[model samples]
Target: MKTKSTTLLLTAITGSLILLLGSGCGKKTVMPPETTMDGGADAGTPISYPAAEGGGYSEESLPIEGSLDDTSTATSVTAAEGMAEPTEEYKKLYGRSTRGLSPIYFNFDQATIRPDMVAKMESNSEYIRQIPNAYVVIEGNTDDRGTNEYNIALAERRAQNTKQYLVDLGTDPARVRTVSYGEEKPLFFGQDEISYSQNRRADFIIE
Candidate 1:
């Protein structure tokens, strides 16, 4: 009876050991893997961010050095600088219409050409000399300060004087015709000295 009791005790202890071992073996301890800049597999590869929906980046929104608007504005300014106003000599060389040329200004109530206008007369003569077949009509004008008849007469004198000067400078006398607009066609509508001065002038129209 004593031997049997010892055997039963030994069996119970062995069963308890087996149950603990089985329970320990059934459970598993899992550890998460380490992640680097490039996911987890490759160390040298670079990680790429997923692109947003629609377009990537606009010219106005990009982090570029110069913006598109700035570049366009710079180009426009450069183009404007390249197209400077043409000089009188350049206009003459290109045979541009005298109507497009700057008018010769005169003093108030004066039919006589001013001393300062001599250079302009010379330049006009030079332009006419270059074009032998080109005929020019000198339109004389005056401010509204004088009577219609008086202004008309003054304008005629101004036109005649301008024509004579051009003829003296080797331009053909027949090619230079004269007309008087009197106070009819004013270059400026204002009633001021500057406007009157602009109105009292001879306009050369190339024909």
Candidate 2:
């Protein structure tokens, strides 16, 4: 009976030792957390990705300033292009004489023929009558107070008024033509009142 009891105790101790060894072998070894390569962040902390290669723009790649000024310059060029071009007949009669009839002057921004210039128109009409099959171009001009476009329109009104007056004085309507010089062909260059008044005149060109 004593021997059997001793054998049972040894068998139980051997079985417990085997179970502990097997459990130790089955467990996995634990490793430490990895850090960023730059070592800037702590372990288990998130690191932002680097900026995309060549993705951002520099100052040199941006659009230029003063775009409004560029637009203004382009508009000025377009306005200049809109001005009237001279005709071949106008080029031929540009510097020709108008006999004794002088250039008729106007008041500031006025297209109406003054009473003083009535005689001049009559004389011009008589001179036209003297010459058979002669045509005359009345060139209207203005002072440099307004824009090219406004001055051109004003000049046209002046020329039309003068041409009508000549036609009323017995001159043939078909023999008369009109053009506007605007402020381009100034009779006097000074900015004073007298110069401006002289420049605001209608010139005669015989063709």
Candidate 3:
């Protein structure tokens, strides 16, 4: 009887040990990366992943979308690079008129004008034509997305395209110049889609 009792106790202890081991060493689950190895996430939002069931990883609170200045480390371009400095008389007469025009937004990685934005561009052309001898500077900008070099080139294309369209609409090509600020000057500094969309545009800077 004593031998049978001892055997039962040993079995029970062994089962208890196995359960403890199983609970202590649970299987770990790893998540797949959000982007490819080359990192081709131009304007892609960073994913917010939840914690794993049994894995140990502390969550980090990163700053999200906000209406603030969030320009990256990009070199500033000068206005003189495109056009001469505005005269005091020019500023007094047409500064408010030109600066008051609303900026036209562009699509992701596109330099062409959108079908919906054609009317707005036409309005801009009319406004430019109204102000006779108005020195116009189209400042090209981009959202905080691509690399510095890529954004600069993209912005230049935007400014160039806008200038060409204005010229095509009877505006003087000599009077209109373009400067690419890339992602340096942001209208809306949020990291979300809305803010990024606002930032991707060409602004009319009356010189």
Candidate 4:
């Protein structure tokens, strides 16, 4: 009996020791890496996180569509040959007169009719003559070299001069309106003589 009791106690103690060792083995922690590598060498495996939801890249990082700007930066242009033109409406708008007559322009700084410009003005006047009720506005502008008040006066003189010329061609004076822009609206914006010359002219607007 004594021997059997001793054997039973030894078996219980052996099982308990085995259970303790197994529990301790699972509780051991793993070490992490100290540097970046392709794969993790330990339990703290390096995971690749994707770019942030909306803040990772810049517009410059995107693929360019067509020709870039003067700089190597990305710019948008027609990416495909068969793509429809984006400015089709603008081209059409400039193609024809929307109102009763197309506009007529004058020579730079000269309100006196030139022979070539007179022929074009006659054609434009015929448009109003065809539609007697048609009305138009003559807008005169000047270059940026003069004071605003002085330019306004000069522009008014040019506009009235054009209107008088049209009236002399048998168009009714009541059907015309005139406005002066006084160096306000330049056809081109630059400090050069070319731009100034462009702005020093008269244009007709039809309503």
**Against the true structure, what is each candidate's TM-score?**
0.53, 0.53, 0.53, 0.51
Model 1 over residues 54-140: C-alpha lDDT tens digits?
A: 755343332333322342222221232343343424332322236434457678888777889888888878877788798898889
lDDT of 2 at 14: 97
Q: Total clashes, candidate 4?
A: 0
Specify the poorest-scoring 10-residue window by lDDT in model 1: 71-80
Compared with the true structure, what per-residue lDDT tens digits does model 3 show for residues 64-146?
A: 23212322312222333532343433332332235556577799999987788678678888887788877898988899898
Q: Model 1: runs farther than 4 Å from truth?
A: 1-101
lDDT of 4 at 101: 45
Q: Write the per-residue lDDT of candidate 2 for residues 99-143, one digit (tens) a residue.
A: 445578789989999999788778777888888688898999999
Order the candidates by lDDT, highest first — what do you get? 2, 3, 1, 4
What's the distance in Å from true for residue 169, model 1?
1.0
RMSD to truth, every model? 18.7, 22.1, 18.2, 13.6
Higher-scoring candidate on lDDT, 1 or 3: 3
Q: Could you tell me the lDDT of residue 65 within candidate 2?
A: 31
Model 2 CA lDDT for position 173 = 91
Error of 4 at 111 (Å): 3.0
